[model samples]
Target: MAKPLKCDVCSEPATVHLTQIINNQIHKIDLCESCAEQKGITDPSGYSLADLLVKPESQSAPEVAALSCPECGCTQREFKKTGRLGCGACYETFASVVNPALLNMHKGDSHKGKVPQRALERATFIDRLGTLEDGLKEAISSERYEDAARMRDEIIELKKAMEAAALED
Candidate 1:
């Protein structure tokens, strides 16, 4: 078996492998999915190795080109080319594309920065409280009075637990 080729640009495991014979000479190019898409080699034109290997997920070139950040007017095509965002709003506007890239780059979507234990606990408590409150409202609206009462009790318990935790700190 032959050794797998890496992408010419990013060195990622090449999914798109192209071979061309010119002037009685054989030449080959290897490209990973992202680099192939970045180079516009994934266009479904004629025959290309990328077309056979990399399938686009949802958005086509036209749709991606059409996407633009409303705040800074940064086009998705520009973002793909530059790999930079124009503004904070671009993160939200281009989340679908950006999120996967972020995961690839950071290995996680959210920042897991070092936080004080108390702060982490507080944040978790707040998040749980908000979720319970929303569920409580939904239960009430749907006339699930029992569920609502249970959630309400849960919320009170959560508040008491948080209070005890704070007192300990």
Candidate 2:
């Protein structure tokens, strides 16, 4: 027969196991469910990861109250409390307040990262084809047949390149 795991706190049979790494060191804890709840580790109403990430301690209540999205009427205070934006327009409305936090979280303001090498050619061709198609539509609407024809040819070439890349995959 195997021995039951002992709880670290009270020597009771443990029902929960937790592992954490702090300062490059691994730490393990064994706890009964009740002890885990008492420590806030298993609490349903405890502070969530979103709350911790979005709610900066530097901002005051008055500042939060004054900031709101013009389109959706979602206040910064509401976002802080709920850790979510009301709509996509809220991003533009609250860009000044959120940009710094976003930059910090993503380590960059714009995406200048690398894509998978295998799909690079196909992805580039598809993006260019989309752009060309949009230009072709604009040209046709403006009654510029020459420009529209050029854009259509470019789009066809890009589609051919995409197909070739797909076959090579």
Each model's lDDT comes to 0.72, 0.68
Model 1 scores a TM of 0.35
Write one digit per residue (lDDT tens) for candidate 1, span 49-143.
Answer: 32322224344666665779999999766665554679999888777666654554345777678999899889999999999999999999999
lDDT of 2 by residue, 1-169 (tens): 9988776656788897776554575445666888667566766775432343343535545665477787889977678677678987777766765665455344555557788886776677778888888899999999999999988888887788777877887
Show pairs that collide, candidate 1.
none
Q: What is the lDDT of residue 51 in candidate 2?
A: 40
lDDT of 2 at 36: 67
lDDT of 1 at 59: 40
In angstroms, what RMSD does candidate 2 have relative to the true structure? 12.7
Model 1 lDDT, residue 146, Cα: 100
Each candidate's number of clashing pairs is 0, 0
Candidate 1, after superposition: displacement of residue 26 in Å?
35
**Native-referenced Cα lDDT, model 1:** 0.72
TM-score of every candidate: 0.35, 0.40
